[model samples]
Target: MLPNIEIIVGTYEEFLLGYQLKQQSEEDGDQVVLKQTFADKSHAGSLKCVAVQGPWIASGGSDDRIFVYDMRTRKQSQILLSHSGTINSLVFSPDLTHLLSGSADGHMIATRVGSWKTEGDWQKAHAGAAVTHVSCHPSSKLALSLGGDQVLHTWNLVKGRVAYKTNLKSKSTLGSAPDCLCWSPDGEHFTLSGPLVVEIWEIKKAGVARREKTPAKPICVAWLNGRVCLAGLENGSIVWISLDAPEDEAAKNISAHEVRIKAMSYFDGTLVTASSAGELKIWSCDIEKQELEHLTSTNIGCRPTCMALLDLSSFKSECPQTSKVVAPKHTNQEKSNVVAAPKPRGVVTIEFEQDENPTIEDDDNSTTSDDTDSAKKSKTNHKKLKQDEESVGQSDDDDCEKSDDSIADFSDSESFGTDGFSNDSDSNQRPAQRKRRNPTPVGAKKAKPKQAKKE
Candidate 1:
């Protein structure tokens, strides 16, 4: 069973600053809910990046510190003064043994979990510009860094060497910046989005395989269900691309919000997207048709800059067994329903095998296009998972029926203010309303359909 969507809104006093949300529940088709909230106690900064590792939720702040908190206990766990400038990105290794962080000062640091000591540090990872993002390969041995230089640099952790580098070929005279990057689950390809286009590059070859320009600048992106990709636009919309389709096929656009989308992520088959206007929305993906349909929308009182998914399967396993309690005959249905509380879904485990040679192949013709195309087509033909809509709808209705419950209310809090921080009194206030805008029309020419051929 997938967890319900979780939303976290950040604030200072009464002004909203940022928000983070995750979509985990697929059976109920309900929108993401408010899971947690973080406010800058001193009104000094906002959250920039977030990483979920086991039971810990780590957040990078503009204050130049990485704050780790326990989700279940809702308490601050630890803080690392690891960066000299604003932290731009944070990622957990595949094994969740170490945390990697990049900052605006052009530094990247790997911190060991148990000792909280620096395992390795690189000061000039991106020259003078800030490292925009850092992603560990699914296998964990390689890491990819993207920055203002418009280049993707791959690093070999075991060998301590620069593995490979690639630059995007942009049509814009002003040049293009790689705003977001994501590797497919299988690690055969990676995609980059910037300016007005999202380009998918094949790792086996050194050239661009497919490109689709959107109407607005893309701020964030992620791969969903192996064969489709989701690009979140700065205009508060999302574009869904079918990688298995022809290159010229048009992407399906989903209307999510009216605020600029700053962060997004996918867990299981659910899509969670956040924006600057303090709105967190969740959607369910149709893997076969490559479509994303809206499920729920919640308002967190602050703008959200980053987000992640937490696996809570371990907690369920540790739950204490309860002895049966007598119930009145008239309440038998209620007692039975309570007894049927679903078991938590099993833990999500991803194993990483280090690649000795992390280098990108130099030969463009190393792999035949026919072979690549066939592989992609076969991957896309996977059977679609049948959704239990009736069960899901009933569960959602039951949740709604308990509207008086304190947990169901998801609105903006009064604690957020423009000062970039909040106080204890504000923390108890109701959340504020989210600002919304109509999505920009999908632009022509630049937003043209993608072609089928693999380049």
Candidate 2:
């Protein structure tokens, strides 16, 4: 595998840094190298969180907005603006079709990836409390979220509604809600940790399977190969919890860095970690033996808050970001709900094509010719339109494609299931939308209505 194929993107201070892990020669200590890609301010405020799936990357900060980017093109794709509070967490479903974002405003919303439209949202997902973390099941059907109210919420992705909620403040033994929540690689269990404790909970039963006291204050957690869970601690050490054998919990605790490890992610036996000291490290793990051999490390200039890995191996195709267009919705058959097993095919169907027929409406400064003259209605909407001449306000592809800003629109339907996870093509779902219309062919005058001549 190429060393730079998978890039590590981390949010440090107000900037976003990208790094690639290169394996060194065996003779030279066999260290892994942390090479920098870009280090620039990506948000107006300190970035709080980020989520990555396939070629799509999203980052949110105190700026109260989410910016989605296409890794293939390295360009900003869409700006999500539904939250009224600082964004806290973001998660893409295993299927890549759903994106769940939580904010300080106590709202967790599910959005369709390609359409970028709000699928189903819980207005008070956490009862007006900030959502701390969200983890979805491998099946992509169920999701669990931890809120500031010391409660946990379970959501049905297919139905876009709350499946159930557990109040931790009233029932758990932790004395307080856990700071971080994570699900295992398999769907059998999940873990909630805070300070000196880590508790594994069974998903099907919604009960604690076991609890282990950490030697150090646990900061974050990530699972590997569906059998082990690694918890990064405030003491700059790692405590490995064995899921395969409950009695072997905390069998290995090793010091990793000199500072608090804030974030970590695992992929195919490789691990990437970010620390409060603005440092990044790479390691190769032997899952059977529960070992992490350090390869290399590097320090940016500022402390990082969160991190995620973007696996490039999945996009080995000729056009990694083969763009797709969004046009007006048309008549088509509906599709079923989503399906998944926790791999990188999450974005296989996602497209990031630049709008070829952009209209004046998308521009912030463009004005309309509404009152100028009914005679000019047949002419172009505005001058210097960055639109395709061959297709004026029409989709080049037969698939329904709308403009970027027009991609997401709220439907007043009672059930969010059809809109949230349905496999139906978008064209079949937008029968009531009237925002866009096919413009008359150029040079064709508007024909007046017919009248009676025998009067």
Best by TM-score: 2
lDDT of 2 at 47: 86
Q: Which stretches of candidate 1 lie over 4 Å from their true place?
A: 1-44, 72-74, 168-174, 314-455
Q: Give the backbone clash total of model 2.
A: 8
TM-scores for all candidates: the values are: 0.62, 0.66
Which regions in candidate 2 have their CA more than 4 angstroms from the true location?
1-5, 23-31, 246-250, 316-455
What's model 1's overall lDDT? 0.69
Write down the lDDT of every candidate, Cα atoms only.
0.69, 0.75
TM-score of 1: 0.62
